[model samples]
Target: MAGGKTINSVFRRLAEEETIRRVQTGLYDYPRYSELLDRTLGPDIFQVASALARKFKWEIQPDGASALNLMGLSTQVPAQYLFHSDGPTREYQINRTKLRFKRVATREMKFKQPESAVIVHGLKSLGPDHINDKTIAKVRDWLPEAKRRQVLRDTQTVTQWVRAAIREICKEPVHG
Candidate 1:
């Protein structure tokens, strides 16, 4: 219940039923679903390379957090928000916070977590580059010291080509 008014309670309940607990009210706790995803792919944020390729019906590699690991930017999390898709690739931003999504293919949509779904919309809205260096650094700093190197190494896997495309999309100044 991201501290919203009573009017939001009903939605919150629905979200919770979907394992999408309100972090405040309109906002929700996507991390909880991340943990669940680790245990089982159900109700996740659809944050995988194969998943996005399937969902968007495009052939694009991940570029942000998912790619960051490939780019030596950071190690992998037991589960972290994913990047990619047909629309736009970016972290969800609202009121200075970011929403996370679990990657999933179009066919796999049924398994995506309810919380992650809303958050993914936020990221899609932000577009790629929504996760800038500052945010990457923040994410890097947030992880445990032991995981820093691995994350950096993993982030390195994220190539600039896709990142540039995503940035282009984000910089488009367009919204649907």
Candidate 2:
């Protein structure tokens, strides 16, 4: 019964009544309305992805473009938000954007904190050549002291240059 028209009809009724909005196949969300924007705001891509991951029991790490955007290092919103996952590779269309999960080795998914994962992937994407004091400072200033320290500890196994960059970001501030 759960797999038949019963469940489908329930969802169809909910959608028809505007109680939930369909995001993609087998996904729905309580729509949020924005008064200033004067429209139903689009779903947050990360939240949607996280929802899917949780539903399907997948571990996901935000890829470079997603990390950069989430960290405020990039002004452009990626048309395709990519994530590395310890799950089957899959894609979903959310609004006008694409959410993709690329399968990877489970080892790559290891990180204690989400922030640490974001920082490491963001740094790897930027590469050693592009990392500098300004970038390090930007990341440092974004994190509270405690979070910076936590990220430092959480990212001990990352690449040498990324680990170095994190060390610089997590270092104590010098007072004159």
Q: Using TM-score, give the best candidate's number.
A: 2
Tens digits of per-residue lDDT for model 1, 1-176: 44655657766666767655443324444434356456522323333333434555644434345444433445554254454444454444433334344444654332133322222233333456565655434433434455433433333323454334323322322348
Model 1 spans with C-alpha error above 4 angstroms:
1-12, 16-18, 21-56, 70-73, 76-91, 94-176
**Could you give me the TM-score of model 1 versus the true structure?**
0.23
Whole-model Cα lDDT per candidate? 0.41, 0.89
Reference-based lDDT, residue 83, model 1: 45
- Lowest summed lDDT over 10 consecutive residues: which window, candidate 2? 140-149
lDDT of 2 by residue, 1-176 (tens): 38768999999999999999999878899999999999998888888999999999998989988998877788797899999999999999898999999999988888978889889989889889999888888888777887987888798888888888999989998989
114: Cα error in model 2, Å? 1.4
The clash numbers for all candidates, in the given order, read 45, 0
